[model samples]
Target: MANKYQRILLKLSGEALLGEQGHGIDADILDQYAEEIKAVQAEGIEVCVVIGGGNIFRGVKGATAGMDRVQGDYMGMLATMINSMALQDALERKNVHTRLMSAIRMEEIAEPYIRRRAIRHLEKGRVVMFGAGTGNPYFTTDTAASLRAIEIEADVILKGTRVDGIYDSDPEKNKDAVKFDTITGDEVLNKRLNVMDLTAFTLCRDNKTPIIVFNMNIKGNLKKVVCENQSIGSTVVWDQ
Candidate 1:
């Protein structure tokens, strides 16, 4: 397979790691993800990752309990640390070189968020997991993925999602929703595709970064996207 991107940032949602249990960390599920990541790395594509914390802990849950929104959000950041550690362990077990970097600065456990250091690690072929939500309370991991993708100068951002590609509407809820095999960034924005949050979408558009949305559950999808050859997902780029 031809390689399309020298480096890429993969954004994994917390829900995707939950597996069938729909709860806290699942070992088998994590191992599966590690294996898939290993396969992609074997293809010589450097991968940077941003995993969401929603599956383990969502600070927003406490918002209804009268907890301060910002404080709750901080809790969410901590939740991401847990997932990051889990991923680090899994990757290491697979004999894949890995680095855990945190935005909130847990100096003892992981490296602080440093653009240059992260790039160096990637250059050495280590998978870097970016923990914490942009070191801010309001931003989502989707935005963090975008910000990191730009900062790291990734060739593209591959979104590993539950769905195979973007749809005109919620495919699960609306059976008639059309699945798009390919689309432009401008059309995604104009049509309000909502594949990602507004901020993330705008950031990618402004940066002129292409994004690929694909089903990560299927084995080898990540490798296909990074390769220049035929891919199994929808590639979204600026309409020229």
Candidate 2:
């Protein structure tokens, strides 16, 4: 079977790892996600992942609570590393080859970020997981995902969120919210839809990389999007 995209960068939220629980990793969610990813791999599509740390910590939130912002951001980066490691472990247990790379350079745990090496890993059909944000404070994992996606020349950023698509308003709070099948980066920015951080969105817009925001918790959605070319979520792209 042919793939809609040869390679994709999948961005997952740390909160998504929690499943129904309030905090920490959910084994069921991890295993389910691994199976889904392996199914995608079996379809012959290359996959790279970037996961956020909001479920564990948020630097901005920590700063608002009077913590040292830099320290908190570092802690947040570590949280991402933890999530990445957990994902790697789960995927490996499923017999999926995966490499966990960190921007922060903790060689004891993960290999330091190397653009060429990561691309090579994908070329060899191994999934690459990037952690630790941009190795800087005040930047988000969203930005890291965008940067890595661009660096790897991924076809699209597959933002795996709980939501089915991007809505004009918070769908959970507003029952009347409308979902968009396709939206421009400008509209997302002009209305502040918060689909991604401004940095990440701008980077994609400038680079002409499209982003697909979809419900990742669903079992076959990933394969549907990449293998069958099904419309499972909103696609955010350059206006022209």
Candidate 3:
């Protein structure tokens, strides 16, 4: 379990939660994620999480359908909360200590996000699940992940995606898409790589937060990326 990073922010898309199902969560995937995360936690790396809501709802999609943009975003945020709660339950089932915090106040469901409290939980070896994207309209959970990582001084952001890593083009569509073992944040922006949103990427670039994009759906990939620092994904950083 040797590693350089002591703390990390892991961002999972809600679509990933859906697993093989057309909609909603897949119990098997949740169980797999829980086991992978448990392995990382056993290595003593503090973990923080931010999950997207595209699987359940998407604000931008709703806006396109003529829904009020603000209302749509609020619904999206709530969707993230649902995903977070599901993840929390899965982790707890594996006996992993976790704290579900929310950007928007939801005293009934989760703790209001407090910097000190969140950090304390990490210090105490509790995984912190941050739900509710930025508590505002027009902000993606990607931005929330970046903001929280910076706030908590995380060493890196582990962007768990369906793809193996960042590539010159969509790997699924383009068999010729070239993968970068390592890339600079500026290069990602210059090439308009689809690793994350511009706002999220810019925040990481400005804060010098290194990001590792890997396929979390693959069993043991999380532990390999975090604990072993194995060459399993594309790494984006401020400097090479």
Candidate 4:
């Protein structure tokens, strides 16, 4: 089956890597994510990823605890690089070609992020993992994902989360929470659904970039969403 999107940017939370562990990454989760990505890539869909660093460090949390905001944010960025490298290694072990690019250059580990180069890598069937959260203090990885998706002209941004989709209320806590299979960007904002930060959501809203929020922990869910176009998640669009 033809893919629903030719290219996609996957946004993952670093906390997702923790996977039943108290802290740090779980080997099983890494392998599962690598396999899921490989399945979608095998269908000829271009994939790029941006993962958050909350599992290791969260700048906002640090700032509240009296740490210098800028310093904490940079520390958060490095944490993202660590997660990205781990994911890259897992993908490589599965024989999936990948490139680790960083907004903050560390030539010793990852290539400095270049727009054209990232697109070219996708064109050659390589998965590109973007780390360091836009290389700016104050911006979240969600914004980084949106920025990269727009720069690469990705068809959509796939936000992998623990939940199956976006809900009217917290599904984990509200048994009666309602899920919307499709919602407009305007509606998401009006309802104040915490999809992405305002900055990230605005970028997609202005650029007409659609977003899919799905459960990444489920094996084969990514393939079902990207390859088969199965309605496995909630889709946020500029218009319904």
List where candidate 3 sits over 4 angstroms from the true fold: none
Residue 23 of candidate 2: its Cα lDDT? 95
lDDT by residue for model 2 over 96-214, one digit each (tens)?
Answer: 99999999879999999999999999999999999999999999999999999999999999999999999999999999999999998888989899899889888999999999999
lDDT of 1 by residue, 1-240 (tens): 468788999999888888888798888878988998898888888998999998977767777689987898888888888998999999998899999999997899999999999999999999999999799987889999999999999998889988888999988899898888889988888898977898988899899898989998887777766764666778898855
Q: Which 10 residues in a row give candidate 4 its minimum summed lDDT?
A: 231-240
lDDT of the structure predicted as candidate 4 = 0.95
Candidate lDDT scores, in order, read 0.88, 0.94, 0.93, 0.95
Q: Against the correct fold, how does model 3 do in TM-score?
A: 0.98
Scanning candidate 1 in windows of ten residues, the lowest lDDT window is: 223-232
Assess every candidate by TM-score.
Answer: 0.95, 0.98, 0.98, 0.99
lDDT of 2 at 17: 92
TM-score of 4: 0.99
lDDT of 4 at 168: 96
Which pairs clash inside model 4? none
RMSD of each: 1.4, 0.8, 1.0, 0.8
Instruction: Decide which is better by lDDT, 1 or 3.
Output: 3
Q: Which RMSD does model 4 reach against the true structure? A: 0.8
